[model samples]
Target: MSEQELIYLLALQKVPNIGDISAKKLLRTLGSAEAIFKSTKKELKLIEGFGDLKINSIHDSSYMEEAEQELLFIEKENIKVRYFEDRNYPDYLKHCIDAPILLFQNGNIDLAHKKIISIVGTRKVTTHGVAFCEQLIEELAPLNPVIVSGFAYGVDICAHKAAMTHGLQTIGCLAHGLDQIYPKAHAKYESEVMDHGGFMTDFWSGSHFDRKNFLKRNRIIAGLSEATIVIESAEKGGSLVTADIANSYNREVFAVPGRNTDQLSKGCNNLIKTQQARLLTSVADLVYVLNWDIQDQKKQQTQLFVELSTEEQFVFDTLKKLGKSEVDVLALQCKLPTFKLNPILLALELKGVVRPLPGKQFEVI
Candidate 1:
């Protein structure tokens, strides 16, 4: 993390054709970014996957100059830089193969031992989407999960605001550099976001604004969280791309279902129909699937007074009698179809009368 090491890392990051995977390979083989640059072409060629073009790009002097300039910006702005190998780097993101070699951060962001989830959707989020996003966060507030989003219009901002309203940390994963904010209008929320959580990005100051940047940034959104939730999206949108990336990372993905005719719901519906995402009707589905421990005393007390429907009560009583039983087994015992039993179990979970165990088993709380 010294100035020289950071400069070398920044230069390595700037090298063309050498992405996070390649850079990691070089760093692991050579032991340091400085060594990678200091080594001869013959030495570099010894590494598998290092071709002539990538080697030539590594030797380009301009990258070093650019790195130096970027370093100056970092110092001037007091930006915190996290090397991928450092403990301060995002834990979930570090597991991703293509995660950035460096992450630039602003504000009092903390991710240690925290339950993090990313909420993303279309920029033109519907009113229903807004209500669902807000209500979801409010219901989840007791568990104190961190909310992460793109900081754009609609669902992203709605998630951030709702998180803040509930006194929870929220992170905005920006497509641009910390030096500027896209959309410009969101400037008002920047300070509040910083105070509550902060802005995170791999891009440097003065980086060109490109449409492709949003796609690149989506990986960060999906990588940083254990789960990614798409509240609303069209047939083609960035949120769908994020869901794909999350699935690729072996992370959980959830999509809110909508009516068949709703344009914004098409993407989510497709995701569910294709079994690419879990069909999420309420926060209870998420809580059950992720098996998040509900340890809040107030929440526990409230659950005691919760009234369950006739079906939910039956399912709860069956689960208690059967002890921990898989969803399939519980369905048989309850004489309910799997589909019908799933919702009843979700309702029981929402009432806090039952808890989901690993391998789709459930037990009374």
Candidate 2:
């Protein structure tokens, strides 16, 4: 793409309410972005949804300067720009008609991936919500799903940290851009995520974090991922918007149900009850839907079974038969202390012979 075309797309992004769909429509009608700039108001209005006011806004020279400056600042930040036409732009996202025209990104990104699941929930999450967020992703760690989230306070932060802790590649899709991180408290997590082949955002360098920008940002999170999971949400919630957007993109949506009467459970329960989302009780539920079974990844379970202590080896041998039995159940069956089971579980998980699941269960590969 040429410099003018690049800046023209940036200027189009700057044009309030002139989103991806409309911008592409105008670009298609005019043959090129430069033609849109050179055309008369009479010529531009021939396109749909271009009011006289929007036409004049596009003609303003200041829009060009703003776009140019935005590009320069992006260069300063060393943020790579992905145009909608770029083959490197997320292939999954490209299918969405409203996908952003340009993205200002930081960190390693391979937009084409087999599994992408976004974890979004209320920032004001309860204690149980926190535990589920951490444990569920920990269980999912073995599958190596490409975790995606908003990087918000409650569930998003937990999901990112958990993925990072397990050394997984996670993406933080921001309401703002690579020039700065929103909330600012997440700078540590963002820095660490970058180190682990993660990715940042869809906004440009100069884009400010306005409230409505989040509504638009949620679409990228939903569109990029194959599935979206709601950990906890109020009757009125942020994750609902992500769920709605994911459904709009024809992606799977799941929500973890909480205690029946908890305020945070309302949105999740309503979602499952109304058939808007599937009830996600375990990592298996997601892995099953995404078809990320380790059955193909199973080269030889024997290769993963070396160097285990007598007790650890015993637990491993037993789990292979039971198919995701709980630690207590394993202890009872093996006639051993489940208390001594933690280190053995970790060792087996590290070696890839056994996979952990929610509620302290383990499954053999």
Candidate 3:
């Protein structure tokens, strides 16, 4: 956008009580932020949500000063800003009613033609939760989904790390401004994260750090993806809050189930029992429920020429014939011992030629 348009937008954003929804309404009515400022009081009053106070705030000169100062910061830091209505803004997030009118981003984020999933859970994650988070990302790497999470401790960081480890793009949704990283201990991961994906936030520069910011940040995590996964959470936590937001947005939510007695499992268990989320055990549950067709002809065409050993070819041919079948059934048909078949299956899986289903079933991707 032009410098004048950005200045007007920033000034409009500083207006009290003019949130994203109201701002959009005004934009639709007045045609541009510059027009909104120049329009008479009668024009502003015509918009449904613009009350006397809100309309008056738009005329305040101080807001322009604040916007100018913020503009300086944006230029100085070389920050990238996204207008909500712009084509470059996240597509899913654009549908959210409360999505920010403006968002700040840093790093190499590319969401084009990609599957995005948000993984969140309790900050005090259990060993099982960590393992599941890592394994889930590893398994999903081939499809090249963008992993998203708050850059907090435990589960969020674990999800980001796992995604990064597997060479997948991972977005860190920050609760505060991009001017600094929270949980200062995680500073070490900043450069690596920027190289792969990046951090995003609506919070402005110099905004005070507060615990409450995280609750507000949760909406971005929920809005950006087609689905949200809660690895583990206590009865009440930010991760559960994200799941709730995802449900509200009509996006799919999946929770990893645990024993009823486990403390961190309560949130996930309740979500399942209440039917707020689907139960997730492995990548298969997600693949099946989301109906993600990894067997796209384009994806398959890229791998059709992969070299395979005679044994591996036999296993692949068997899997292709049956579509998907239990390992024992495949072994019986191929006349190979199950022990020998297992290694062949593992090698195929590593080569991204096959994927395991919930039982002992396997399918060619």
Instruction: Find the candidate with the highest lDDT and give its number.
Output: 1
Order of quality (TM-score): 3, 2, 1
Over 195-240, each residue of candidate 1 has an lDDT whose tens digit, in order, gives 9999999998987889899999999999999999999899999999
Total backbone collisions, model 2: 0
Question: TM-score for each prediction?
Answer: 0.84, 0.84, 0.87
Residue-wise C-alpha lDDT for candidate 2, range 244-337, written one tens digit per residue: 9899889999998877789889999999999999998776567667766565433433472367668768888899879779888998888876
Model 1 scores a C-alpha lDDT of 0.90
Candidate 2: RMSD to truth = 4.8
Ten residues in sequence with the least summed lDDT for candidate 1: 295-304
Judge candidate 3 against the unseen true structure and give its global Cα lDDT, from 0 to 1. 0.89
Question: Which candidate number would show the highest TM-score if scored against the true structure?
Answer: 3
Better of 2 and 3 by TM-score: 3
lDDT of 2 at 339: 40
1-365 per-residue lDDT for model 3 (tens digits): 89989999998877888887888888888889999999888988888867799988999889888989999999998889999989999999999999998999999999998899999999999898998898788768767899999999999999999999999999999988888998999999999999989999988888888878899999999999999999999999999999999999999999999999999999999999999999987776787688887666325434556777898898899899999999899999999887567656755775678888998899998
Clashing pairs in 3: none
Model 1 misplacement above 4 A: 296-365
